[model samples]
Target: MTTNQRRAARFNKAFGNRLAGPLLSRMPGFGAVLHKGRRSGRVYRTPVKIFRTAGGFTMSLPYGPKSDWVRNVQAAGGCQLVSLGRRFDLVEPRVYHDREQRVIPRPLRPLLARFKAFDFIELRLAPAGAGRAER
Candidate 1:
């Protein structure tokens, strides 16, 4: 990580959780990615900037790919997305940089583009008939 990214991560860890996390996690068009710690086995809920796609949801990784939640999700191979008052069992995790920003909303694209936040974490919902649990 660059110096700026390291600093930003520190700031997010110190303030984002206490300030923005609770509010963002519950709002529409935004949700929490639920993943478990690889070693500790502790559950973590991370607030993310979410965009709906044809198949599932795409989220911006403001803290970049090195974020703990990202690693946890990748390690577990899936995670739960709590959004729209529903809990979805998301599978087939994919992380990449969408430089064209095609999946991002038009209004937010410019702002996100400023931060060069092209790294994304994508999760597709499990098939409808597959049993899943609620929040």
Candidate 2:
């Protein structure tokens, strides 16, 4: 990889593990985790901001579909969610489209705008069972 790409990768890895993971765990409605691809089997942990919807918990991937975590979620159809020192299994993910992006709350628009450069994808995570550990 190019120097810049290498730098970004390094930064993402460290930030996800050391910073994002912990912070998301403390949030009221957040359910972030480290997920792996079932096919490629590559591992990556992403800090996802989740919103509760009528269907379930929808997590927007600001970085878009090209991101490793997004791709992994697609491949695995499921993932292990780590939060508040607990791990829970997530169900299959369904990708949402641009038109549907508008459904995202207005308050998060600025944060979502940061992904304008990428192909955005949203995944709804369903908790496998009741009383799943928080972190």
Candidate 3:
């Protein structure tokens, strides 16, 4: 990672769980969580903006395809989403293909464009009540 990338990662690691967690919960369209990679088993808890869609709650992987969290969610087939003091298990997350990219909402276009260097993934969560129990 570049120096700035490393620094950002460090900042995220430190403040993400402690400060970002509660802050994200207060945001109208955001959620935060720690997710474990099914294969590598590494875990990352970070902040994400979520929107209610026809299928379910959708969040964009703006950091792009190489992001460890994105890969982990893909491998694990789901992830843990925490918001407003509640946690839910997200399932069936899939990367956004070329055609699907055109449909990304305009409000999120800027955020998604920032990660243009990396491929984006759109994650859809399972129903609230159907989430797996927290460990």
Residue-wise C-alpha lDDT for candidate 2, range 28-132, written one tens digit per residue: 657665677666666766776666566445676554455677667777676766655666656667775564366578776666665542234444445545324
lDDT of 1 by residue, 31-107 (tens): 88888999999998888888888777889987788898899999998898887677888888899988888888788
Per-residue lDDT tens digits for candidate 3, residues 77-106, read 888777666677777886764534555677
Candidate 3: misplaced stretches above 4 Å? 1-11, 14-18, 38-43, 97-104, 111-119, 127-135
The RMSD of every model to the true structure, in order and in angstroms, is: 1.8, 4.4, 4.3
Residue 131, model 3, lDDT: 67
- CA-lDDT, candidates in order: 0.84, 0.61, 0.65
Error of 1 at 127 (Å): 2.3
Give me the overall lDDT of model 2. Answer: 0.61
Highest-TM-score candidate: 1
TM-score of 2: 0.64
Q: What's the true lDDT of residue 76 in model 3?
A: 79
